[model samples]
Target: MLKFLPGILLLQVITVVLVLIAPTELSGWGWLRLVIPVGIVGVLTAAWFSSMAAHHNKDEISRLQECHAKEREALRVNAERAKHRVIKQAHQETIQEVRRTSTQANIKVGMAFAGAAGIGGLLLLTQFITLGLLMLTTAGGALGGYVLRIRQEKAKMELLPKTKTKPRLINASPTTK
Candidate 1:
């Protein structure tokens, strides 16, 4: 009430004092004198509060939009990090597969070499050199297969992107013997 008292007093002062000072043709219109100003003040106050509510609502909407944008940015960052982790894990698995393939190719190469030596020696002792060519051909085929497998593993390794290894933080205890 105190906050509005000045405005109310000003309205009343205008209605009574302004008409009395001018003594206009409408001054004798007794009730119209007070009613007109009261109605005008009421309309002006209503428009003021309506515009104020609109401004407040606009500010609130902008604040909410900012909050939502921040949340979306956070989600995007987390999703990007998750994708990086998945790619790293895939690379690790690919490296492991390449290692396993290399090991298998080496074993195959050794077996082919050993088989060739054994068959060649056996055929030499029996004096069947012409027929021994078939055994040599078989060993050659195994060696070719080994070479192909090794090449495949090398190609896979080259296809992978290079990643730096981060130093791991190991859990160490001083009491350990």
Candidate 2:
């Protein structure tokens, strides 16, 4: 009704002008005489229906807006969940990498110890050095291997990206509403 006000006013103005200009022109009841009344009624009815349709359309538009808002909120929630999942996965990967690195370090240390023991045994059997020298060399080799293993482990750890020990705050709440 409100939207059709302008159209109604325009129609009224045109009707008044036509009536004033042709007072006796539309007085006859021939087929041509029916045209003016029919046309005027058709225009008015079309304007009324168009206004009603516009109201219905506005209602539908509001409903669609609400649906769109809900969909946007759902997408936001899903995005947040995905972000948290990625952080968790990264943390797990970091833990696995650290464990793998530690295991390799232990294996290297074991191999170094075994090789040093084999060398000391060979030296003792061949009498390459006195018993005291053999003991000193074995002790020195064992100590050196232990220190080298520690250094290697430190280097390997340093090569890896450090993982955050504490859980991170991914999203902070807004101070203003």
Candidate 3:
């Protein structure tokens, strides 16, 4: 069936040329003029379908495969970036949380130190030097706690992986962090 294309095309081309070379007027074979074109079209249609039956594929399979591959690649890249966005957003939130915690810790340390200074003053008023020194040591401990919290936050930041800058276009590759 597939071997009939060249023969069918040649026959069609010859018929068309013969018709072209003939007279323009169709007074003699009026019905034949219409039937000839219609018959040729039917024959070509039958030949194309029969060829497909023998060959298993008549359409452009390679072109369709290329289209599907491109679609798959785009979808794959989009899925990766979607996952990256979630992780990147979480990392930024964690950094912001660390900064907030550090600020609060420092504020609390300042208030605690102020209270300790008041206690020291009261002790001094009563002439209790040893107890006043104890209050000062307690204040030092509060400062130490503040320093530890900040240091811990810094360590946490260090442990976290940084996110890289994303490209403006989907086709562009991501830049390193």
Choose 2 or 3, whichever is better by lDDT.
3
Residue-wise C-alpha lDDT for candidate 1, range 1-177, written one tens digit per residue = 354566657666766665576434554577576567667876876676666668878999999999998888777667766777787899789979977987886887797688786897689679988667777777778778877886897798699887675433233245766
* Residue-wise C-alpha lDDT for candidate 2, range 1-177, written one tens digit per residue: 576677667777766665556546454465455567658766776877787888889999999999998888777777777787888899789989988987897798778766766777777778866764676577677778787888997798799987654433345465796
Clashing pairs in 3: none
Greater TM-score among 2 and 3 belongs to 3
Regarding lDDT, does 1 or 2 come out ahead? 2
- Best candidate per TM-score, number? 1
Put the candidates in lDDT order, highest first.
3, 2, 1
lDDT of every predicted structure (CA atoms): 0.73, 0.73, 0.76
Better of 1 and 3 by lDDT: 3
User: If both were scored by TM-score, which would come out higher, candidate 1 or candidate 2?
Assistant: 1
- Candidate 3 residue-wise lDDT, 1-177, digit = tens: 546676667767867776776667768677587568757776876777677665655356766888998998788778878877887889789979977986887788788798897898789789998999798788888778878887897798799887577624455577899
lDDT of model number 2 = 0.73
Off by over 4 Å in 2: 1-27, 30-38, 121-173
